[model samples]
Target: MLTLAISLLVAGAVSGILAGLFGIGGGAILVPVLVQALAIMEIDESIRMHLAIATSLGIVVPTSIRSFLAHRKHGAVDMALLKSWAFVLPLGAIFASAVAAVISGASLKWIFTGIATVVGIKMLLNRPGWIVASDLPAQPARSAYGLLIGFFSTLMGVGGGIMNNTFMMLHNQPIKRAVATSSGVGVLISIPAVIGLIVAGWQRPELPPLSLGYVNMMAVALIMPISILAAPVGARIAHAAPKRALEISFGIFLLVVAAQFGWTLLN
Candidate 1:
C-alpha cells in the first residue's frame, strides 16, 4: 500500500506538469501511470483499465476547471461556442462512459493505443499542413465535431483539450484562442464523464479496494491536489521554453506509452 501510494504521488506530480506543458490534460499520462501502479498491487486485469480511466477523470475535474478559469480571464475562451454546446458535450461524454461499461478492458486499451499513436505521430511531425478546413463549419457540423471530441475524450480519459485544440486550430482559429477555449471544453466534458463512470461500474465485483465503482477515490485523493499545483509549473516552463523541442519530447513520450499498452494487449 505504501508503494502504491508513493507511485501515485509521483504520477500526480508528473501528470500535472504534463497537463500544463501539453495543454492536453493529465489523463493522457495518468491513465497509463495508474495502470502500472495498480499492476503492482496485483489488481485484476479486467477492471484495471476502467479504474484507471475513472480515477483520471476524477482528477481531471479540478485541473480542467483551474485551466479553464485561468484561460477565461484572458478573454480568449469562445463564449458563444461554449454556450452552444451546453447540452451536447455532456451527452457525448455520458454516452461514451455507458459504452465503456459493456466493452472489454482490452478493447479500451486498443482504442487508447491507436489514438495515442496517431496523436503522437502528429506531434512528432509538427506539420503545418495536417489541417482539414479553413473556417469553422456550419451549425450541425460544428456540433458533430464537438460531440466526437467529448465522446473520445471521455473514452480516453482525457480533458477534451487534445482533440478540441487541434480541431479549432485546423479550422483557422488562432492558437491562443484555440488553447484557451479547449480548456473550457475540458471543464464541460470531464465532470459528467466522472459521474457516468461511477454509475457505469457501480457495484462491480471486480473493483479493487478503496474503489467506488470504476473510480478509486484513494488514487484521486493521492493524485489530484499535487497535480493541480504542478500544472502551473509546467505552463511556466512552456511559456519560457522552445515549444518545438517540447512538442517533440512529449510526442516521443506518447509513442512510448502507446508501445507499452500495445505490449500489454499482446501478452
Candidate 2:
C-alpha cells in the first residue's frame, strides 16, 4: 500500500510538471509510465495497456477541467465552439474505447509504436510547415472533427490535443486559442472516454486492484490534484511562449516517446 501510494505520488508530480511545461494533459507521458508501474505492482501484462489507458483518462478528466477553467480565466477558450461540439465528442469517445478493447494488446502496442515513430520522425525533422492562422468565427461541423478527435484521442491515448490544435490552426485560429480551445474539448473527450472505458472493462477479469471497470480509481485519486493544480501554470506558460517553439518541442518529445513505445514492443 505504501509503495502504491508512492508510485501514484511520483506519477502525479511527473504528470503535473509535464502538464505545466507543455499544454498537453500529460497522458502522453503518463500512459507508458503507468503501464510499467502497474507491471511492477504485478499487474497482468495483457491488460496493463487497457488499464493504463483507462486510468489515464480517468485522471485526465479533472485535470482537463482544471485546465479548461484556467484557460477560461485567461479568456482563451471558445465557449461557443465547445458548446456546439460537445454533443458529438462523447460518441467518438465511445467508439474509440470499444475499438481499443477489441484489439489485442500486442497488436495495440504495434499500433502505438507506429504512431510514436511518426511523431518522432516529424519531430526530428523539425517540420516548419505552419498551419494558416484565422479566426473567421466559423466552427467545424460537430460530427466531423468531434468524432475524429475522439477516435484518435482514445486510440492514441493522448487526448485530442494534437488533432484539435491542427484543425484549429489550419482553419486559421490563433495558436493560443487553438491550444486553449483544444484543452476545453479535451474535457469533453475525456468524460465519456473514461466512462466508456469503465463500461467496456466492467466485466474484464484479471484487472489490478482498486479498479473501477477499466479505469483505476487509485490512479485517478493520486494524479488528479497535482495535474489540476499545475494546469494553470501551464496555461500561463502557454500564454507567454512562442507558439512555434512549443509545437516543435512537442514534436520532438513525441519522437522520443514513440521510440520508447516501439522499443517496448520489440523487447
Candidate 3:
C-alpha cells in the first residue's frame, strides 16, 4: 500500500507538470505509467489497460479543470473554438470509450503505442510557422475533426490536447491559443469518457478492489489532488518558457516511452 501510494503521488506530480507544460492533460504520460504501476500491483492483465485508461481519464477531470482556469486567466484560451467543439466531442468520446471497453487489452496497448509514436514524432518535427490554412475548417470538416479527436483520444487514454493542439496549429492558431483551448477540450473529453468507462466496465470481473468499472477509486483519490494543485504551476511555466526546447524534450520522452512499451509487447 505504501509503495502504491508513493507511485500514485509521483505519477500525479509528473502528470501535472506535463499537463501544464504541453497542454496535453497529462494522460499521455499517466496512462503508460499507470499501466506499469498496476502491473506491479498484480492487477489482472486482461483489464490493466482499461483500468489505466479509465483511471487516467478520472485524473484528467481535475487536472484539466485547473489548467483550463489558469490558461483562461491568461486570456490565451479560444472560447469560440471550445464552444464550437464541445457538444460533438463528448459524443465521440462516449462512442469510442464504449468500444474500448470491449476490446482486448493487448489491442488497446498497441493502439496507444501507435498514437504515442505518431504524436511524439509530430511534436519533434513541428515548427512554429507551420500552417495548412489561414482559418479553422468549416462545417462538416470541423465536425469531423472534433469527432475524430474525441474518439481517438479517449481510446488512447488522452484528453484530446495533443491532437487538438496540432489541429489548431494547422489552422494557423497561435500556440498559446491552441494550448489553452486544448485544456478546455480535455475537460470536455474526460468527463464523458470517465462516465462511459465506468458504465462499460461495471460488471467486469477481476478488477482491482475499489474499482468502479475500470476506474480505480483509490488511484483517483491518491492522484487527483496533487495533479490539480501542480497543474497551475506548470501552466505558469509554460507561458514563461521557451516552447521549442520543451516540445523537443517532451517529444523525446514520449518516444522513449513508446519504445519501451513496444519492446515489452514484443518480449
Give candidate 1's whole-model lDDT. 0.83
Residues forming the 10-long window of minimal summed lDDT in candidate 3? 16-25
On a 0 to 100 scale, what is the lDDT of residue 164 in model 2?
71
Per-prediction TM-score to the true structure, in the order listed? 0.93, 0.86, 0.96
C-alpha lDDT (0 to 100) for residue 138 of candidate 3: 89
Among all candidates shown, the one with the greatest TM-score = 3
Query: Which residue runs does candidate 2 get wrong by more than 4 Å?
Result: 1-10, 17-23, 120-129, 132-142, 243-249
Per residue, candidate 2 scores C-alpha lDDT tens digits across 78-184 of 78777877787778988988987788676666666676666556445533355454343345554687788787777766666656766776666776787788777
lDDT of 3 at 97: 83
Q: For residues 86-160, write the lDDT of model 3, one tens digit per residue.
A: 889999999988899779998888989999899899999998788999999888889899999999999999999
Best candidate, lDDT: 3
**Residue-level lDDT tens digits of model 1 in 1-267:** 787787788888887776665565788889998998878878899988888888898998888777666666557778888887888899999999999999988989998888889888878886655667888888998889888888988999898887876788788886667766777787889899999999999999878888888999888988999988987776665455656776788789889999999997898
Error of 3 at 245 (Å): 1.9
- Candidate numbers, best lDDT first, in rank order: 3, 1, 2
In model 3, which regions exceed 4 Å deviation?
1-4
Model 3 steric clash pairs? none
